[model samples]
Target: MTNDMKLNKLLLTLSVGALSFIQACRSPESDEKLKSTIQAALETTPGIEVNVEEGNVTLDGQIGSDSLKQNIEDKTKMAGGENIKSIHNNIVVNLPEPEDAREKYHEIIGGAVDSTLTRDVNLVLADFPTITAQVKEGIIVATGNLEKSKIDTLKKRLEHIKPKGIDMKGVISR
Candidate 1:
């Protein structure tokens, strides 16, 4: 080949390699696009603030009921799809005060919901032998060593219960 032809061929090969390297290094999902998807899911629900980073999402706002809060979270998760890594549902449920708030609280303590939560939490823990969790008063405290790959899946399953909060601070991930 002529010198000019060899130079052109080398440039084309370098260009192809560069493109391949970039494509291989790119993440499956972009944070901005994922945020838009989640935002669309929560658009009908007011007072919601959605933030996404590296596929992790945080939903913060005020809503009327526990069920609504869970519903909003579910919608956003579905819309976020397989790209989601983790989610924090910080939306608060503003339930109207009962005639006697203390009495209402007592009545619900150890109620069927709590029983179910206890049972469900145990079941979840069983699935993750390396991790242990405790449920009390609508909150979950988890502690143990977990594989890094399982973190998102475990978090999603735990969030499905719509707990007041989850404290995984004691858990270590590899």
Candidate 2:
């Protein structure tokens, strides 16, 4: 080979080797940046934890819902950028089961409904418009838009039932 041809071949080989080295090398600073990026993105959402090392990220802890989990994962992958080689998602879906408020609190408010029914169906319908009462774990929750006068009467009626507490916060007076 001519001198110029050999010099060109040597330069080509060096360039390929440098490219390989650059591709293989991953800096701790980049890992830290990735982690911080994920943290900053997910900081407002509680129970999400991120750990990154050498372009690999591991997500731990819990998320409230499936949609929320997906949202977080999408944001994480986006934030991790092209440097992320793999993600090990170990996120748990932690959600509290909805309480069967009616079943649990039926006995507490059942008598009131029964008493109202016994007096007169029209009375029940007139006195309580779309009224719903449920008791869960000793707490009573009543929902409906009630007049102030009806609210006073309902309170008096519920007083005899003796619940742990009555939550009428959802009830708006008209």
Q: Considering every candidate listed, which one attains the maximal lDDT?
A: 1
The residue pairs that clash in candidate 2, if any, are 105-135
Q: How does residue 58 of candidate 1 score in lDDT?
A: 92
- Estimated TM-score for each candidate: 0.40, 0.50
lDDT of 1 by residue, 1-174 (tens): 999999999999999999988654535458788888888877777779988776778999976557567778888879988878789999997753323332333333333344446666787788899998877776789999999899888988888756667889978999
* C-alpha lDDT of all candidate models, in order: 0.74, 0.67
Q: Count the backbone clashes (under 3 Å) in each candidate.
A: 0, 1
Best by TM-score: 2
- Model 1: runs farther than 4 Å from truth? 1-29, 96-174
lDDT of 1 at 61: 90
Q: Using alpha carbons, what is the TM-score of model 1?
A: 0.40
Candidate 2 residues 64-106, lDDT tens each?
A: 4455566678878888779789888889966432233223224
Q: By how many angstroms RMSD does model 1 differ from the true structure?
A: 16.7
